[model samples]
Target: MRSFVTFASAFLVGLISFTNCTKRTSSTATQTGGGMAAEQQLAGDDLTKARANYTNFCGGCHGRSLETFVNRKWQHGDSPEALFKGIKHGYPDQGMPSYDTTFTDQEIRHLVSYIREGIVAQKGKTETKSNAAVLKSEKLNFQLDTVLTGINVPWAMAFLPNGDMLVTERSGTLYRFTKAKQLQKIEGVPEVLAQGQGGLLDVKLHPDFSKNNIIFLSYSAVKRDGGQTLSTTAIMRAKLEGNSLTNQKQIFEAQPYARTRHHYGSRIEFGRDGYLYFSMGDRGGTKVNPQNLSVHAGKTHRIKEDGSIPADNPFVNRQDAMPSIYTFGNRNAQGMALNPTTGDIWLHEHGPKGGDEVNIVKKGANYGWADVTHGIDYNGSKISDLNQKDGITDPIKIWVPSIAPSGMAFVTGDRYSGWKGSLLVGSLSFKFLSRLELDGNKVVREERLLQDIGRVRDVRLSPDGYVYIAVENPGIIYRLVPVSN
Candidate 1:
C-alpha cells in the first residue's frame, strides 16, 4: 500500500492527535509545548454526549464503524479535534454537514472523547474509556467536538455565490449544499467514466464564473483499444446549466495509449499569472514518459487555460519533449500549491518506501525519483545511497519514515496567525496535518497537528476564513473554523 504511516507508536507515548503530511520546507526541530488544552469546566457526561451525537449524526457517511482507524493510526497518534472544526463548517459543495448549531458544545465534547479512547482501544483491544482531556498542539490546534462524516466520495466541488456549494460525486452524481446546512442531490450531471482513479477528478470555475457560468472537469474517458480494455485521461471544458455539465468540449487528451485506470495525475490550478498548471502522475510502472524527455508523464506542466503550451516552454525547441513539462521526474505527486506571497509552486509527491518529499517546484528542474531518491528499494531492499549527493536535486524536506504525503495548502487565514507564512501538508501515512515554516525557497521548522486525525488526503482553504480537509475512504470533507472573537 503506497501510504504514509510515518509515526512510530511503539516509541511515542501519549502524543496528542495531530495532522501529519510532508511538504517542502527545511527541517528544524519544534520546541513548542507538547500538551493538551486545559480541562475546562464541563459536565461529566460531555464526552459521552459528544460521542453519541457524532455516532448518531455522522455514521451515515463515514461508515458504521467510523472509529476503526481509517488510516490505521495507532497509540501516541493524532487526535479527533482535527475533524471537529471541519464538521462544524463542512465544504458545503462536497455534500458534508455542519453541526455548529445542530449540537451543543457538551455533545461535541463527548464525540472527541469517544474518538480519542477509540484510538487507544485499537492498541489494547480491550480498554475502558478514560476521562482525561485529549492532548493537542500549542501552536496548531484542532476542534475535537465537531466531526466530518456522511459526505459521499465527491469527484469535485465548487463554492456557490452565497458560500454554499455544488459537488459532483465520482459516480456521476451531483449534490447541492446550502449555507443553511442542507444537502440535496442535484438532478442532472454528465455521465462520468468511473472506473479507477479516473472519474470526475477535479472541477473548477472560470475566474468569471459568476458571469460565464463556465466550469471545467478532468476525468478518464473510455477509448476503444482493439478490444475492451482501454481509456485515457481527458480534460473537458463545459458550462454549468442548473446542476448539469452541458456543452462539455474535449480540450486536452494525453497522447495515444494514455489509457490507465490509475496514475491519472490530474490537477489544474489557475496561476496568478493567468496560466494553468497541470500535474500528470507516472502511469503505473517505475518508468514511462516524463523522464524519457519524450512524454509528459509524471510531470508538472504549464498550459494556457485554453490548453495551448506557451512557445517559450523550456523544451519547446525539442521535438520529443512535451512543451507542458514545467518540472520532470515525479511519481504520483498529488499535492500542489502556489505560495500566496512569492507565487512559487509548492509541490509534494508520494515517495516509495520512505523519503516522501516537499519541494519548491522550479521550472525545468529535474526531481529524481527512481533515478535519484532518499528512499530504500521497495520490499525493504537497499538501493543506491543517493540522497543529497547525486546531481539530482534534493528535497527541501523529507520523511525518513515516509508520511505518505497527499494534499497541500498554504496558511493564509487569520485563525492560524502563528502559521501565517507556513504550509500545511496532509498525510495519509502519519494521519495528521504537518506544518512547515518557510524562508523564501527553504523550509525552516516543522510541527504536527491532530495526532489522531488519520490519513488527511486533501487540504483546501475556502475563500472564507475556513480550512477544509478530506480523509480518504469512509472518506469525508471537513472544515477548520475559527473560534468566535
Candidate 2:
C-alpha cells in the first residue's frame, strides 16, 4: 500500500504451479555437486519434476504461485549457482529472456532444482487471493474535514494562488498550509534522499501562478560514484516566497542513475496546452529501460514552462528519442490528472502482484510494463498473460489485489454537486477514496470514497471548490465537506 520499500534479503518459499507444461528437451545432463546434492535428494516425483520445470519455462515472468520471491531482493543470485547464473545468462537488459538456448543444462538444472528446494522453503508463506477486485464496496455523498494536522509523509499538494497549502514530505520536509489552518515548516528544502522510497516528492503551482512566483518540486536527488550511490527523479524551480523556497531552479533530472529505492514516477500536471507534464518512476529501471528510447526512467515527460523540449514533442525528430518522451512502458506512475471535463490526460500505474492500472493518456503511447502484464512475478511467478498486446496501451481501469494507488484528482468546482466530474483516487493500499465514474473515457462506475482514511496520500482540487485529502499515518490534511445528497 504505497510503502513496500524492502530491498530483498529473504522471503521466497514454495508452491509455484499454474498448470501447463511439457517442454523439457535440451540435455547434456551435467550435474555433479553444483546441483547441490541433487537439490538435496529431490523427493516425491523429483519434486514434481522441479515444480513442473518451473511452471513451464519460468512461470510467465517468474511467478506461478509462490507469491513472487517473498521479501524479494534479486539483481540475480538466490543460490543454486546463483540461480544457475541468472537463468543461464539472461536479464536481457532487465526484461529477462535467456534460457541460453531454451533450457537444457539439464533443463537449467531442473530450474536450479526448483529454486533451491521448492523456492527457499516459501519463507513467510502467503497465498490467499480473492479481494473481489480490490475491495470496492461502494457508498458516497462525502464529507471529511481535518484540514491540516501534524503533516509528515504527505507527498504532494499545491494550491497557493493565495489559498495557501504546499505540503510534500516523503521525509524531506516542506509545509505551509494556511487559509488559517496553519502549519508552516518550509525552509529551503533541497538536499533530499530521505532513503527508501526517496523523500520530499511533488508540490506544483505555477501555470502562471498569480504572475509567476513559480513553484514545482519533486525530489529524491543524490549522486556520488566512487563507492557508488546515485539516485534520480529531480525537478525543482522554486520561488514561493513568504514561507520560504526562493530561486531554486533545476528543471529536470532522472536518467541512468538508480540504486532502486522504489519507482519515483513524480506527478506535476499543467497542459491545457501550456505544456509541462511530468512523471518518472521506472527507478528500478531496466526491462530495457521501459522499451528504451533514451531513458528518463519509464517516462511520461513533456516540457517547456522552462525545461524546454516542445517542438511538437513525440520523440522530437527522433534521433533516438528522449525529447521528454510523452509515454512509454510506464511502471510506477503515481497518479496524474488534468481532465477537468475532458482536457484528457489521466494515468495511474503500479502493478506487480496484481495489476492496478487506469490509463488514458495517449500521444506516442506504449504503456506496457515489463512487456505486457496482467500482473504477477513478485514471485507468484508469471508476468504476462498479455493484457491486450499488439502495440500496448490499454487500461481504462484495473486493480486486483492492489489498491496501492496514490495521489490524483479531477472533479471540478460546484462545491461537489453530485461530485462533478469525479475521479478522485488515492489509496495507499486500501486506505480508500476511489470515485471514478466517468463515461466518455470509460471507467463507468466505482464508488469507495474515504474508508479508513489514513494512507490515502494525495488528492487535491481546491481553488475554492474544496476537496483536499492527503493522509499518511499521523500526517493529516482533510477537507472534503459536502454532506446531504
Candidate 3:
C-alpha cells in the first residue's frame, strides 16, 4: 500500500466543524427532543471488540481515528435502529456495504451508540436511553456518510453482485467493503508507481461481473528512460482475488514520459462492440502534442480485451501511425462514460484554464483543444468562439468559468424517480454534482446537487437506485437520498 498521508485532525474537521450533513436542500433525520439524551457504553470485552472490529475491518481505509467523514454531523447522533438498518442494508452501490451478518445486533447497536454519543457530546447534550428507532440526527434531505476514511485517496469504485464494493485509492490501495459497510483493506495488489500523479487511478468491473469476476485498473507505470532521460505511462490489467490481485499484466504504455509532474489520462470502459476504449494525456505540453498521429500522447485508444490492437482499428494495419488511436486533439479528459442508452461515449475534459467541455466522443475525429477553444491561455488569451466547423468536434456543453468536471454517470434507477434520465456530473473545482437533463443526445435541464458537500470528484448510480458522489477533500464518498420529489 502506498503511504498516503492521513491526519486524525481531518476527522474533527469533517464532522462537528460543519454545522450539518443534510443535503443543502432537504433532509430526513430530525434534531429534537423526540429521542432521549444520547449516551454510550464501551467497556471490557465490548471496548475490545469494537476496537478490534474497527481495526481489523475498518482501520485500513478509515484511518486509525476514522478521520475522513466521521466529523460530519450526519454520521453522528443517529439512533441505533436507524444505524442498524443503514449498516445492515449496506449502501453497496455507494461503496458502503452491510455488515449485519458478521456483527451481532448488540455490537452494531453499541457501535452506532458510540457514534451518537460523540455527536450528542459535540452538541453539548446529556445522556439518556440508547435510542435505536428515533431519527438518526436531523432529517436528511440527501444521503451522505463517511463510507471509509483511512485508505489512500480512494479514486474510484466498482460494485459486485452481492452489494459489495471494491474501491481503489490513488496510492495503490485496494479495499473491500462488506454489504454492511465494514471496510477491509485487501492485500496483494501489485505495486504501483505511487509518485507524482501516478498511482492507481480507476477501476471498472466487467459487465458480466458475476460470471468473470474480472476487473480493470489504469495507472502510470515506471519504465526505463531508454536512450533519453525520462520515464513512461503504462496501464495494467489484473484479476482480483479475496485479498490479492493475480495475473497482473501491462496492456498499454506510452512512449517517453514527460518530465513534468501531471496529466496522465487513464479512463477505461468496454464499448458495445466488446473493444476496450481507453485514453492517454498529451504528457503535459503545449501545441499539437497529442493530436499528432505519429505520437501516442493525447489520444483516445481502442484495443482488444487481451491487450492486442484491433485489426479494424481506425488506422488498421498501419505502420507508424497508431492503430489504436480512436480520436485525438484533447487536453486532459479525465472522465469518459458510455451512454448506457445510446452506446456512445460521452467525454468531459479540462480545457484551457476556463473552457471545460463536455463532448460526444467520436471515432477517428479530433477535438480541438489548443487549436480552438472558448477558453483563454494560462496568462489569458482567448482562443476561439467555440465554433463548429472544419475538422474539429464541437463540445455538447462547455462551462465558462469551468467546474473542472471529473466523472459522470447517467441516472437510470428509480430511487429518485425525478432524476431518472438526468446526468449526475461530479465537479471537483465546484464541489457539487451537476444534474443535466438528457433529451436523447441533447442536454436540456441542469441542477447542481450537494452544494454544501466538499469537492465532488465522481458520481455513479448504485444498483439499488441511489447515486454516489466521491469528494476529494478529506476524501469521502456520499450517497444522495431523495426525501422529497
Error of 2 at 482 (Å): 48
Q: TM-scores across all candidates?
A: 0.69, 0.30, 0.69
Estimate candidate 1's alpha-carbon lDDT, on a 0 to 1 scale: 0.58
lDDT of the candidates, in the order given: 0.58, 0.68, 0.60
Q: Which one is best on lDDT?
A: 2
Q: How many residue pairs clash in each candidate?
A: 43, 20, 31
Error of 1 at 74 (Å): 26
Instruction: Tell me the spans in candidate 2 whose CA falls farther than 4 Å from its real position.
Output: 1-35, 38-80, 84-110, 113-223, 234-250, 254-258, 261-270, 282-304, 307-331, 334-341, 359-396, 401-438, 444-485
Cα error, candidate 2, residue 129 (Å): 35
Better of 1 and 2 by TM-score: 1
Model 2, 1-485: lDDT tens digits are 11111111122211122233333444554445323224554667767876765654443233453434544445555767677766665543233434545455765666576666555686654322222223223333554666666654687888877678788877788888787877888888788776556778888888777897888888879888899777789888888778788888887887778765567778888889988888787766536677887778877898886787888888888887778888888877778989867687797876664667888778888887878866664434465667777888788888765566778888876777676887888866456688888878988888886565556778888778887878664567777666554
lDDT rank, highest first?
A: 2, 3, 1
lDDT of each residue in 1-485, candidate 3, tens digit only:
00001111111101111011111211222432222224367778877776655543333223323433344434322456556566444432122334544455555555555554444444422112122222121222444544555553567877778888888777678778888978878766656665444567778787776787777788766544655434345667777777677787777777656554345666778899898887676655546466577777777888877789887778766676877788888776777788888989887776543567777778787887567776543212344555455888877777755565667788775666666777777665445678888898888767876653555556777778777777654667666656541
What C-alpha lDDT, on a 0 to 100 scale, does residue 342 get in candidate 3? 90
